[model samples]
Each structure stands twice: as C-alpha cells, then as structure tokens.
Target: SQQGEEDPQALSIQEGENATMNCSYKTSINNLQWYRQNSGRGLVHLILIRSNEREKHSGRLRVTLDTSKKSSSLLITASRAADTASYFCATPAIGGGSNYKLTFGKGTLLTVNP
Candidate 1:
C-alpha cells in the first residue's frame, strides 16, 4: 500500500518566491524522503528525514517530520523557474526486508513561472 499523500495537488508561483508542500502518511515508517521530477523524467532524491528526526535542511530545501502525526513537509527557499517540477514524498514498503521498494505519493505539481 502507498504510505504517503501529498497536499495542494498543484501550486504556481512567480520566480524567487518560496514554495511549501506537505505530506501525510498512514503507518509508521523508518524514514521519509522527498523527490523532484521534471516533466517526462524520472525522479531525483531531494532529502530524507528519518523517523527520529524532527527537521533537516539541504541547500535551499528544508524538511520536517512529525512521526506522532505521521506527517512531513518540504520547504523550498528562493525558488526559481528551474525549480518547477512535480515533488513527491516516499517511504519504503511495509515489508520485504532489505529488498523493500519505495512507495511514492501522488505528488504535488509545482510551477515556478518567470
């Protein structure tokens, strides 16, 4: 079963504006990760926040996790048109041991217009 559900199905903003996206999950997870995908392309990992971590940051991206609520959020600072893409939240499958695969959310489509 898919674990995460992202909100605001889509967002549009001018360049230089910050964009925020959120995700809510159904079950306990070992870790939560964010990914970005350009149109007609595969996804690229953005950041990962473990269940034990409350917050993490990489470059202009910030991520926060709340295991108690089974939710997480990603914030992109100083956004640019190039940052436009579909962002998704993912978690490992519930079972499958070391061979588990990632289950992704529906994704939030972000459009940064110049």
Candidate 2:
C-alpha cells in the first residue's frame, strides 16, 4: 500500500521566494524520495533522504526527514517560474522487492508566479 501523503494540495508563490511542502507516511521506510513532474512530463528524481540521515541537499532543493514523526519536507530556495510543478513524495512498498517498487503520494502542486 502507499504510505506517503503530501500536505497543501496546492501552493502559490512568487519568484525568488522559498517554497516548502510536507509529507507524512503511515509506516517505516528505509528512505523517502521526492519527485518533480512538469506539466505532462515524467517524474524526475529530486532527492532521497535515508532513514539515518536527517537532511539532504541538491542544487536549490533541500529535504529533511524525521523517522520518529514519520514525516518529511521538501524545501526549494530561490524559486523560479520554471520550478513550478507538481511534487510528490514516495516510499518503498511494504513487501518483497520493496527496494525496486515505490508508492507515490497524490502530490503537491506548486505555481510560481513570475
């Protein structure tokens, strides 16, 4: 079953500002991954924070994980119109081959005004 769920179904922000989205899961995860989809394009891997890691960063993106709370958050700094897209949090499926399979959340749509 899908474990991750993202909050703030939609978000609007101005260019150059920061945007943050939160995700909460119902069960344990070895790692949580964040993905970005622009319009109709396929999902692009953003970042993955391991259970043992507290935070991770890639380019303008930052991800924080709290296993105790079964939640995670993604932060985008210095946002741009191109950054506007739907972001989804994913967790490994609970069972065999979990490492190869992922369950994604509904996603959080972000609109950055230029």
Candidate 3:
C-alpha cells in the first residue's frame, strides 16, 4: 500500500533562502527517498535514507528519517530559482509479490522566486 504523504502541499520562498518539506507515512518502511520534479519533466532522485539511518546529506540537500515516528523531512539549503519545483517522498510498497514498486506522496510545490 501507498505510504508516504508529503506535508505543506505548497511552499514559496525567495532565492538564497532555505526550503524544508516534510513527509509522513503509514506502516513500516525499509527506506525512504526524496525526489524533485520540474514543470513538465520527470522526477529526479535527490536522496535516500534507510530506516536504520537518522540523517543523510548530499550537496545542498539534507534528508532525515524517524522511523519510530514514521516521518521524514527534506531540507534544501541556499535555494535558487532553479530549485523551484515539486518535491515528493517515496516508499516501497509493503507487498507486491514479484512486481515490487514504489509509492509516492502527492508532493509539495516549492516556488522559489528570483
């Protein structure tokens, strides 16, 4: 079943500021991942954190997982206009037999103004 559910539905910030998005999920997950999508484009993988790990960082992005709470957060530092896009959190389905698949949240729309 689908798990991740992103918070704040939408966000707007000026360039150079920081942006933070959150996700909450139901049921246990082995790992959680974050992705970004530009308008009319496919999503890009940002970062992933395993259930065993508390936090991870990659470039300007930081991800944190709290499996005990079944929640995660993503932080983007030094946000730029190019960072304006939709962010999503994904988790693998609990059971899909041989057809393993990932389920994604509705996403948070981030608008970074120049």
Candidate 4:
C-alpha cells in the first residue's frame, strides 16, 4: 500500500490562529512530504521529513513523523486567510517500478476566516 493518509477531511480556523492535520500510512516510506494547493493554484511543497527524522520545521510550518507508529502530523501556526487551502500528505513509495510515483491522500480542506 502507499504511504501517507491525511485525516479530518476538512478544517475551519480563524485568521491568525493555528491549524493541524494528521496523516497515517500503512507501509514503510523513505520520506513523507506535505503540500498545499490554493484555489486555482498549483500544489506547493510545504515540508518533508525523512524516515529517520522525528520532527522538522519550516517557517510557521511544523511536521512530525513517527516511523514506528507510521503516522505524521502537520501544524501550521499563525495561519491567515491566505492559508485557506487544501493540504495533502505524500510519501514516495519505495520499490515502485520507475520510482517516480508519488501517492497522495484525499487531503484536508482548511478554511481560514479573515
């Protein structure tokens, strides 16, 4: 099975607040990544954490990966209305043919009120 399955389906938060999402996977992965896509915009890479890593931070984004539990979490701090978008977790599945395949979850739609 592919890795990274985000939950909550959707979220609503006020501007300047925080938003958090969780993800789980069934198989081992080399690294887990998060991405965001605003309305009519292309997907942008948010952050990535290696399998050996436990936590990582980039700007207001924080990511936590637990390999043993096979889960990950993404936390966005001081979110703004501009942050309103769909967030998805992706994991590069290992041993897949050409290895360029990326499995993405359905994603969690976050609505930030201004």
Top candidate by lDDT:
2
Q: Once model 1 is optimally superposed onto the true structure by TM-score, how far is the C-alpha of residue 102 displaced, in angstroms?
A: 1.0
Estimate, for each residue in 39-97, the C-alpha lDDT of model 1 and write its tens digit.
Answer: 99999999999988999999999999999999999999999999999999998775566
How many pairs of residues collide in each model?
0, 0, 0, 0
Ranking according to lDDT, highest score first: 2, 1, 3, 4
User: What TM-score, over all chains together, does every model reach?
Assistant: 0.93, 0.94, 0.94, 0.91
Indicate whether candidate 1 or candidate 4 has the larger lDDT. 1
Candidate 2 structure, TM-score to reference: 0.94
C-alpha lDDT of all candidate models, in order: 0.94, 0.95, 0.93, 0.90
Per-candidate RMSD vs. true structure?
1.6, 1.7, 1.3, 1.7
| Candidate 1, run of 10 with poorest lDDT | 92-101
User: Which regions of candidate 2 fall more than 4 Å away from where they truly are?
Assistant: 95-100
The C-alpha local distance difference test score for the whole of candidate 3 amounts to 0.93
Candidate 3 residues 1-114, lDDT tens each? 667899999999999999999999988889999999999999999898999999999999999999989999999999999999999999987565666579999999999999
How does model 2 fare in lDDT? Answer: 0.95
Q: Give model 1's TM-score versus the native structure.
A: 0.93
